[model samples]
Target: MSTSGRSRAAGPDETPAIGRPRDANRDVAILDATLLLLTEVGYDQLSMESIAARAGVAKTTIYRRYRDKVALVAAAVEYRSQSSPPAVGPGGLRGNLLTLVQWLAEQIAEQEIGLLGALFAGMRSDPGLAAEMRRILRRDEAAMTDQPLREAVKRGERLAPHAAELFAEVAPAVIVHRIVVAGETCDERFVEHLVDDILLPLLRGHPNKPARTERGTGSKGTRS
Candidate 1:
């Protein structure tokens, strides 16, 4: 709700003007309404009229800012991301990763399953919406991984060459799979296991065993 000092993704025609400044309150109202509707209904069912009604603003007011539904939804997604950024806690890589994954798990768990399903459906059906969401998600994922990895470097930790990319892939995939796909609880124990057992070994490039070479073909392989 508090958008002070936060930079939002620009609306379609949201250029600066010399006229009376746009009301920040109205922007907040509109964005909040959009997210609420997204959770309640979905991208396919959501409309400018519904958002306008929920926000208590004219339909024209919504269109005047955003070019279309995709643009509006994209802006809303960006706003939500900017509003609730990842909370990087104090400590080294392990501590920070645990904190980050726990936060991510909590956020994912808070979302309604229906909303998640709707988003998945929408993304599959709508190219424009999928593209917009992907762009926003990639940026967020980078932000989530960059800080902890940078700090780990400062601590003289020997990380794998692609540590950030690896973390970005492994942690979220496991968490989302546990909650959304497997319908399992992503509790504290699970988070700690993910960080200690899987992620830490991976980032530090600690292989479980040395590669074994086949005698005939001379092909090397490691156990999964």
Candidate 2:
């Protein structure tokens, strides 16, 4: 959940400028500063000056790299969410989903929930930030769900149409709703319940309603 210290190279849209290359050190510093400030003050209170002061760089330096705070904040969020692919379990779909849910729970734990809620609050007012959030989340959701389903298919399992979309929504929707609306943290147990009781059964195309299993029975639920 930590942001990488190595700065990314200029993106596709970056204009070719006839000058010294952008300083990688400054880029990391700026991003690091932005993340820290986000946790401290939330999104609305953040500004270019405060970020520059915290990062020990000039405001113009930040502007040269990012057009505005929305883009900068988006970049910071993307950086925070960077992680290796979720580990697939040997139990096929069920195992893979358990790993995926736990991984997401860990990521969510690292984030300051209030800070995230603040960002969500700004989504309506700032179309650019909202679009960026959607883009990143969609790309991430695809990666998270697609690989597991493909592996399951390889193992001779059947999958439902729209399964990927359905499974992808479960973790994020539940996690965010828990944090933002329900005012609860999604502990490991809740995440296990979500995967085993809800998501796994849905992907299996069972028509019967799910029954509540014993508290520690999630692992059992995955066993064939």
Candidate 3:
């Protein structure tokens, strides 16, 4: 449906509504209108007036659920994202992180460049939008420890002192940097390099060197 600016996705069957049940079909119609407008007009050009006209719902109906532009945009982003909790399992740090990164890659490749791209800029003027973006990023960052910590505690890995800061900051930071700053694509190989070369060493209390081979080298089993 929409992810507003967050990297979540909603299937066409989902609604952008919450807090109470709504006229199911009506909400879906409004969201369909929202997504269509987002794709066609971009976020800056999107307006409540356009949503009303597109949905055949009065502006009052739209306003009744969403108090302002920020709320409506957030709902649409969450809707399209089908925002679900991070996958949790005994796979520990590595497993949890892989799912998290894969989701980020997909969202950037699929949603951010299309219907939701403009939401990124909207954050400049809207604090709520900025918070949503941070919330989405933090979920992945915080997930690194759930199982890993449990396992480390069992084996008495001591949880290394700097580990907390590293997990919560570095992995997400690189991905964010690559996407938001360097404009690099987060392909599967890159994620693998990050995990094998970057994350594993940090977890083990080693330097943050992720092993790598250049573009033309033969594939090796080493990290990167």
Q: Write the per-residue lDDT of candidate 3 for residues 120-221, one digit (tens) a residue.
A: 666776687678656655553444355555565675554456675676667656876677678878876677777667766776676655434322255444
Assess each prediction's global lDDT (C-alpha) against the native.
0.73, 0.72, 0.63
Model 2: worst 10 consecutive residues (lDDT sum): 1-10
Model 3 bad stretches (over 4 Å): 1-21, 83-86, 90-92, 135-155, 158-188, 203-205, 209-224
The Cα RMSD of model 1 versus the native structure comes to: 8.3
Which wins on TM-score, candidate 2 or candidate 3? 2
Winning candidate number (TM-score) = 2
Q: Candidate 1: where are CA atoms >4 Å away?
A: 1-13, 81-90, 181-184, 207-224
Worst 10 residues of 1 by lDDT: 214-223
Please tell me which model should have the higher TM-score, number 1 or number 2: 2
- Among these predictions, the greatest lDDT belongs to 1
Can you give the TM-score per candidate against the true fold?
A: 0.77, 0.78, 0.66
Whole-model lDDT, candidate 2? 0.72
Name the runs in model 2 displaced over 4 angstroms. Answer: 1-19, 176-191, 207-224
- Candidate 1 achieves a global lDDT of 0.73
- Candidate 1 lDDT over residue span 1-224, tens digit each: 11112447457558664679787788889988888898888788999999999999999978878988888887876676543545556657777876888877777676667666766777988999899778766777677788888888888989888988888778778878898788889876677677766788888897452212211243222211
